[model samples]
Target chain A: MQRIAVIDYGMGNLRSVSKAIECVADNAEVLVTSDAKLISTADRIVCPGQGAAADCMAALNDANLINTVQELIGTRPFLGICMGLQVLLTHSEENDGIDCMNVVPGQVKRFASPLLDTSGQRLKVPHMGWSPVAHSVAHPLWDNIADKARFYFAHSYYCAPDDQGSVVGQCEYGIEFAVAIAGQQLFACQFHPEKSAKDGLQLLRNFVAWNGKS
Target chain B: MGLAKRIIPCLDVDAGRVVKGVKFLDIRDAGDPVSVARGYNTAGADEITFLDITASSDNRDTMYHVVEQVASEVFIPLTVGGGIRAVSDVRRLLNAGADKVSINTAAVHNPELVQEASDKVGSQCIVVAIDSKCVSSPGEEPRWEIFTHGGRKPTGIDTIEWAVKMAEFGAGELLLTSMDRDGTKIGFDIGVTKAVSDAVEIPVIASGGVGELQHLVDGVNQGGADAVLAASIFHFGEYSIGEAKAFMQQQGIEVRL
Candidate 1:
């Protein structure tokens, strides 16, 4: 049986994320752990995170899994969600400029727009609710999921990747930002698939079946 | 694309079981909280709000378990409220799989609890729920007053002012319910709903007094609520989440149908 490790660094909504994975996993053994050996040995890894970048990195460092995760990124079928995607960038404007894992070349910045829609109605900060995400590049995870499908979002900051090729999905919240990024053996999204309903569950199911070739 | 207007189904849970009552009495068991939430999820509820009506200390564990069960299977944003007193309470619920924690009586009492929880847990996870009722006089201007203790006790705080203050205190969202209209199933108090919603910068979820599907549309269009929350209309199967979303969509409201 294939083992999938969901790295737990003591932050984020681990329970829901793990449960969503378990709901979709058939032959795969889903494990939520901070154990480096267990994560490294797993066939696939999901690095799910929430909260601020500084706190997230601190928890990761406290667990001594920084290097372990860095090694797993290129070697395993890795998935990042929300802060999991932000922390993979080079840096973030949050917490007065915190250095990230730099697995992907990018910087996370806050939504500095006037926070208004075209009609002049004030847009709520945190950007909470469902917003349609438009795909830029094709990937196995996008299979069966319609382009521009609505996904649940609850974040103030967004990722600005240096390598545009890594961006597979973009969403507009006063300003268009990368909502999903894909790379060799890696797939990351800003929205929470666990909270996204049918399309989200389908994406997770696809991730479980993906071979990480592209 | 802009954020879609949400149609949330609120479950009033008592002793780990989902129940819906009129005016906070005559409780009738709807179903298990987890199962009801799962039904809403598959039925296409934009979000789910679970309010523990009997938020007693002994029942805390049961509520947490219900939240966990629902979060695991529902696969949608879950907001849990009731009996949340402090930052610690908010932290516990979030860890238990709630995406947001709604604080009511405690927030009205301490006021600072809103800011403290917002700062500690991030404003995105802190929701301030205000229960208010309109007060009118023969020659005086009508105003809404804040109520606590499940809308039994009225605080002197002005509803609009309190809403503005709550938003300034870093509350990411506000769940505003009109006490007089609650459980009446007539319609939302558009005056108070618009008052607070227009007063706050954060998203406002207009709740209470939802009799039919048109009430929901009025809540969003007339009340200017970012979302509309209903209980009996959904809990009793008079309206399904899909039907609500369809109605909202037909009304030109942006809903994920």
Candidate 2:
């Protein structure tokens, strides 16, 4: 059976993510751990997190899992969710500008304050609840999920990749932003598929069966 | 196309079973919280809120188990509220698979608890639940005061001002319930709901009334709520979540169908 490691670096609760993966991938062994040894041996790696970007970086550094994450993203199939996707960028504007992993060339940006939608109504920060994500590029992860599927999102900041071509999916809150990004074997999204219902489960199933190819 | 306005069905769980009451009294059993949650999930609810009305401390553990069971099977966001007194309580619920924790009485007692809990477990998971009642007289400008202990006692705090303070205290969202209309089924108190929703930058969920489908629409269009939450209308099978969303959609409100 294939093994999947969900890296847990003292971040927020990962039970939902691990549980969702287990529910979808019955043939795979899903391990939620921060141990580099077990993580390195896994066939696929999933990085999921919540909270501040600076705190996430600090926890990753203190756990000494930064290098392990960097190496795994290079060779194996890797999925990043929310803060997991933010920390992959070069830097973030949150917590007074914190440096990130630089695994992907991008800058994480906060939603503009006093953000107004097309109707001139003020949009709330954190961008909580479900929003439709429009796919910008086709990939294995979008296998059964329809384009522009509504996914659960809860964040105040978003990633803007330097290379626009790397953007796989986009969603509109105040301004259209990159909600999903890809580079070789790496796929990351700002939305939490684990909490996104049926369409979300389909995406997880696709990831489990993915061969790390575009 | 844009962020869909959320329709949340609240399950008031008491001693491990789902119950509904008219204005916090005259309680009636609905069903199992887990099954009710699953039915709502299948009906296309955007999110689920579990208000633990369990009075005794001994039964609190039952709320946690209910959350664990629902979160395991239901993929949507689950929020647990009631008797959350400290940051530790918030942590325990999140660890139990709840995506968010709503703090009401404790937050009113100590506003700093909001800041501390939001600091410890990112603001995204900290929701400040405000139970307010209109205290203004006829022909007088509408004024609201915060209430505690299931709307039994009144604290002279202004609802709008308190909402602003909670947002400043790092609360990610505000769950505003109008005590006057909570179980009356007349609909949300749009005046206070709009006031609080417009006063803060964080998302506000308008809760407590909601007799019919139009009430849900009005909560978004008129009250400026980011989400609308109702209990009896859903728990009693008055309207399915899909029917509400479809009605809202027909009224030109953006909703996930």
Candidate 3:
């Protein structure tokens, strides 16, 4: 099995991710690196992001490995998580009027509805917690992960893909949004798989297995 | 959107380790923060809060060691508080890799400290952790009294009003805890939680009084909290990270899967 390169752009949680990958992939080696040379040769690439999409994009820009990532994703089996998925979109509502990676045709948006069950009838923003998710499509990532599998989440902004065909999973808060999306071999999930339990581990395992066969 | 509910795991880091408290006072047996963090991450914690309970006392030698170790190990966003007071204290924790530095008693006395730290480390990094209690007698308007120094002293400040003022001064998030429910685990103070969460524009992490997974859902769905924070369940091994995630998933909420 070819080693999977988990990009360490200093934005995503690399340590915990590395550990989870190690636990799941018995044969596949998970290498955390920001080096272009090492990543360019890897069979699979995974990009994970936790903070704001703008900050994550800025980190990618600072690292100067954006183009290398672009080229590799074109040929290798690539996956992006959260902000990594958003950067691939057309732009974001977060940093209003900023051009993104444009890897996918979409725009990241914040949840707009005001769902309030409070005493005063108001809810807060930055929806953070574990909630149910319904699978929208049958993709390789869902090979082991089941419908309604809970994954940890901490973001107000979500990716609304322009191409509905690319969306592989759907989750509903006040409304439905793409939880997981894909373009050929390219895949991404807004939720943090490393933090999610068995389903999350299985999701990572599926990616690893996909990388092995491909 | 309305204020979102949050699922947070409070890490009571005692002497460079994550310990569990029976009530808020009794801290005896607990695991390491790094391991607990990993477990929560896997279980699907929305956000993680590390309360350096003893960071303010004389036994404060390992300020950075504990913060850096846990932060480095987990990939999730973290809010480190409990003993942070000075500007340097905020900077040091942020430097050590904490995503947010929460201030309690400091923000009460030096209200301007909120602006100072916000200016220095960015408002996004400044989390004003407010501990409050309900003093509303049915007929009269609800009074949310603020508690500080670990619920030992009353600040005589209205939590709702203070939350509004703090937001005006540039606090990015509000970490609201119910002193009455710290370790009771009988669900959160919904009224207090609703007030603070509704009053503040930024995210409010509804904490204290989380007994089961249903409380987590209620914290978000009913209380209108952006995030929900708990400790005992994850710490005492009563629940695994996977079960929490699965339970949330069954609730029709959107979580990472």
> What is the alpha-carbon lDDT for the whole of candidate 2?
0.90
| lDDT digits (tens) for residues A81-102 of candidate 1 | 9988999999999878999999
Against the unseen true structure, what C-alpha lDDT does each candidate score? Answer: 0.87, 0.90, 0.73
Q: How accurate is candidate 3 locally (lDDT)?
A: 0.73
What DockQ does every candidate get? 0.72, 0.78, 0.17
Q: What is the TM-score of each candidate against the true structure?
A: 0.94, 0.97, 0.75
RMSD of 2: 2.7
Q: Residues B10-101, candidate 1, lDDT per residue (tens digit)?
A: 88888888765322222333467766776677778889998988756887778888888888788999999998887887878888899999
Of the candidates numbered 1 and 3, which has the greater lDDT value?
Answer: 1
Tens-digit lDDT track for model 3 on B126-195? 7888889876687888788898878989878888999999988868788888998888988998888887
DockQ of 3: 0.17
Cα deviation of A134, candidate 2, in Å: 0.7
DockQ score for candidate 2? 0.78
Candidate 3, residues A1-214: lDDT per residue as tens digits? Answer: 7798988886644655666677788888789899988888888898876555666677888888788877777687887876678788888887565678888878888767464443444334454445566678777778866677766665667889898988887776666779888776788888777655667778888888774222
In terms of TM-score, the best-performing candidate is 2
Docking level for model 2:
medium
Q: Give candidate 1's error at residue B73 in angstroms.
A: 1.3
Q: List ranges where model 2 is wrong by over 4 Å.
A: B21-30
